[model samples]
Target: MVLHVFHGAGYERERVYAARVMFEEFLGLEIALHAGQEAGWRIVRGEEEDGKELRLADVLFRTPQGEWLTEKAMPSRPVPRWHTGGHPVKAPLVAPDVPVLYGEEVPNGGYLAVWDGGLQIGADLLGGAFWMLTRYEEIVRKERDVRGRYPAFASLAVQEHFYERPVVNEYLEILWWALRALWPDLERKKRRFTPRLSHDVDWPLMGAGRPFFQTVKRAAGDALRRRSAQAAVRRLGGWWRAAAHGDYDGDPYNTFDHLMEWSEQQGLRSAFYLIADHSGAGEVDGDYSLEEPWVRRLMRRIKERGHEIGLHPSYETYRDPRRLRREFDRLRLVCAEEGIEQERWGGRQHFLRWEAPGTWQAWEEAGLDYDSTLSFAERPGFRCGVCYEYPVFNLLTGEELKLRERPLIVMEQTVLHRQYLGLDPWEAWVLIDRLRTRCRLFDGEFSMLWHNSQLVDQGETDLYRRLVETM
Candidate 1:
């Protein structure tokens, strides 16, 4: 099916990109945007060969294009007013009470009117989608945490407290419902809910990666603070074995076996993003070398077990294209030596530190196929307001790149860490289940990050098991 999208002037490139995201990318249908016409007109869907047609007239939705002006782009103090809450949509796949964003609300109950002659839509689905997908807010807003990363609290999604909802998906569903209403026989691209598991190898071998003083300090804490002699001994033993015998697997964070075994049990392959450079990786970011025998052994095991090894750029590489390229090359060179012939290369940014199209551009220029680094570190919901993997477009360059974004939905730390969502195992389960259910509702892919070092704690290990089993 070919959808002829008629629209008025202003933001032609933006409109084209957003329409592609809405129709071609999200809905999996062919579309053509016809400009120079009154946008408050009709959308015509037809068969190219037979010339059969259907039309939805009177488009009442209009994007506040003026808001894009540099000075006025930022959301106001009362952000929730600009966001739709419990908005009703007619998509058969999702709940009737769904959330939306950035679009003006009409008096009608539904998000947009599915009329035969009148305005079929009054919500700016394309505009809202474009705003969220391109992360327009992040670029306009400069507020950052101490780590120089965008703070989750400042995001429009969190400001409106809809961080847990994939509003972009809801927007697409509204558009799909409108199309299906006009042509009942319209079939969307079939999709299945997929669980994409990944591990960021920040501390693959906890004993070997830290400074001696730091390790000793932590050992002291294990004994004095926790009052556990056995724990202290075990920590010291891990350090000794790794240092004296190169037995890095003896370290508490060397839980690669457990990860591979669990994924195998689930008939899944987990992606392990390895840190390839250390130029800007502070002590806290891990100091393990990819050239180490232990890391090489681990990589070999991962490949032998049919898992994936990807690049995890160092802490400060996100903003530096030269550093990014050097790190990527180092990883590929090591992979080639180990006979790990991966057709595609991709990974996450350390600390999830990214700077919009710049980081994305660096990845694309460095020959990476995808980047799963779009999640907020302090919050683990839809930072990009999406759960699906879609090709990204540079809002600055106004050109689509080859890199696709696999938006991270859940990071173990985001839920388990005391500083973030701060949920217990049960609470974490509830929150994760809600996120996963949302993905299933839209047949979207769910990507999760669970650091190997986190599993050293038995309680965290058990929680990890439950997450994998449930997925």
Candidate 2:
């Protein structure tokens, strides 16, 4: 069935495009874009006519009579409602009279609701979804961290107290309910949400790849910085084991084999992103070389065991297509040498350093299948307003890129380390469980990242183990 959308001249093409994506790609429905008026299941930007229609104009669409299309609407704000089963939600799209058990409301706008036999939504859901999906706020907001990334605190969701919510998915749910009421015969596909586990081999082995002097310097620095003799002694022991046995498997940072074993025991697979090249200056990448014998052996082992090996593009490659291509080429060469032939590849950027459209364009140019780097470094939540993997769009040009994005939901360090949230193990576990429950609600993929070096901490390792087991 083709759902006809009647967009007026005041409607932006990008908004219409986003709505089309939501309806066709996400909702599995056919859309027929039309101008002016049309027949059967029509969506318009003005007050309802004498016939069947739905209104999604409000903030985005204007009437031909030179008047605003909706009621005196205000900018969306968090509406701390008792519904959503403890999940955060923006303003609701249904009326209070409809008896919606799960929804929110704005001040004067009431709830975003459907009228005229479910033919209309009173709010600008398409606009809201478009804004969230394209990260429209981030594009317009001029906030950046030291690494040129948008911090979580700067986000509209965070500022509005809904960063923990997947608002786009909630919008989709509103759409789903409307569509079901409109067309009862529509067959919607049931989605099964699953956990996507990935590891960034930032420091494959803490002591294995570093030069002897560098290792000694790190040990001494630890002693001086923390003023702890025990830490100094522990670092020395780790270095000795790494140097003598050529295998630091017993060391906390060298947890590759353990990771594989744990995954195997859980009957799951994970992606391992290995850094191929280090940056020249003013940037830090992993110390290990992709061509190192031990690294090669590990790569081969990961692939042999049915896990994925992907390129962890260096920090400098985030905006440079040429640099990204070169790094990916090196990774491909090494994988070929290891006799691993993967048809499609995906990865994340080092330090999560990315520059929106530029980084996305670079990933497409480098021929990556998907990228899982759209999350906050300082915090963990729905970075793109949705938990499902979706094709990325260049919000600037309104062009859809070839690359799909599996947005990272959480990173171990984001919640655990003192540099970030500094949550205790139990607190971190509770947060993860909450996020996972949200993912399940939408039947969306929950992507997680754990640095190989972090596994050295028993608390982190146990948390990871619990995470996998619970999933």
Candidate 3:
């Protein structure tokens, strides 16, 4: 059968996706057309082969406006008697749990098939406006401080970091138009949404247009408050504790059901980090108390769905090593009763705010197996100066901390915030491209943190889908 491989102009530039050349070479297919060629697709090879071999065609190109340009003539190739799905392919789709069976020898185990597992993409804007507002205040304070050192420093910093910079503003406009053009079907008809404009967007604010941000902010804040209140009610020795521990059973967030589908789709197994005392005093704005029953049920559901549960240390938990241990102990009991492993290992500090050396000491004392919270507080670049996971050592003591640091590369809030490296879609794309290049070279995982709520399909979030697709 004819195997067609369309090499679009832009797609050819992506090194990750450029393996089409090798694929074409192995298939012995001749390109009948080059879609993005200046003079349209000109057949470089014809029926020159003495025998009938499969021919491939480049059938697509990019127009000036970034739309795909396609050609009309189609090519056909002889189907091999042994070929299936247009080619003689091997194991096109494998079952999720297909294990290799060894003949005889010691008892057989499943066959080992390996693929690049380090590559990943995600975003997080959890705590939404709460986190952004704090960041905004911090930025203003920094701007003030810098002005004392140098008069022009404030403007320089603003131009470089703030999302309201001229470059970001121009890019955002283009990105907005582009997303609207691409996904008109997903557009909301109600103009009542104020756009989260660049100037009005604080790190705590949601997106690009103020009007739209207000709408989402109200809805999101209300939901957050409700979730917070419900959590508080549960923590008051209420039925939530019983329900979560399976004394009374029901799933909150339907986490098990949804995660099952999602994990299956991505061929991934997740490790969830649950906050032990989200509402406790000194938990750093941890005023929202979720029911113990809800939290327990969620943990059970996560385990049932084949995911691991870890601890998301409250703000003060890191401040006191003993308190951190106590928190983990309490968490372990929940896991133990559920017939799951009770060890509290992984951690992601709340707010990605931590004194590096001090926090490393706390993690070592608490014995976390891995931590995924290392990233720049003011930008979305590599904080540890590396793209790969490595041991995090205490800066003061110069001793290796007893944990692995999986540096977070991207978070949704960082890009959308008015402070920090507030990037629009185009700038975000440039960042992604650079990160992707590094990942390709080092074969490193682009571990990202995207909050579930930030996946909303409008306003300043235009780059999200593109980010995912590019990766």
Which candidate tops lDDT?
1
lDDT of 1: 0.78
Alpha-carbon deviation at 249 in model 3, angstroms: 16
Q: What would the per-residue lDDT of candidate 1 be over residues 192-211, giving only the tens digit for each residue?
A: 89999999998786565556
- Rank all candidate structures by their TM-score, best first, as comma-separated numbers: 1, 2, 3
lDDT of 3 by residue, 289-342 (tens): 224454466568778776667766765654567777776766677678877873
TM-score, every prediction: 0.89, 0.86, 0.45
The alpha-carbon deviation from the true structure for residue 227 of candidate 2, after best TM-score superposition, in angstroms, is 5.4
Which candidate comes out best when scored by TM-score? 1
Name the better of 2 and 3 by TM-score. 2
Q: Please report how far candidate 3 places residue 327 from its true position, in Å.
A: 1.9
Residue 68, candidate 3: Cα error in Å is: 58
- Stretches of candidate 3 exceeding 4 Å from the true structure: 1-260, 278-291, 342-344, 422-430, 457-471
The clash count for each model shown is 1, 6, 30
Candidate 1: minimum summed lDDT over ten consecutive residues — where?
52-61
Note the Cα lDDT for every prediction shown. Answer: 0.78, 0.73, 0.39
**lDDT per residue as tens, model 2, 179-286:** 666556766666888889999988776565467788788778768885656556666777778788865665557788878888788888889998988777342775
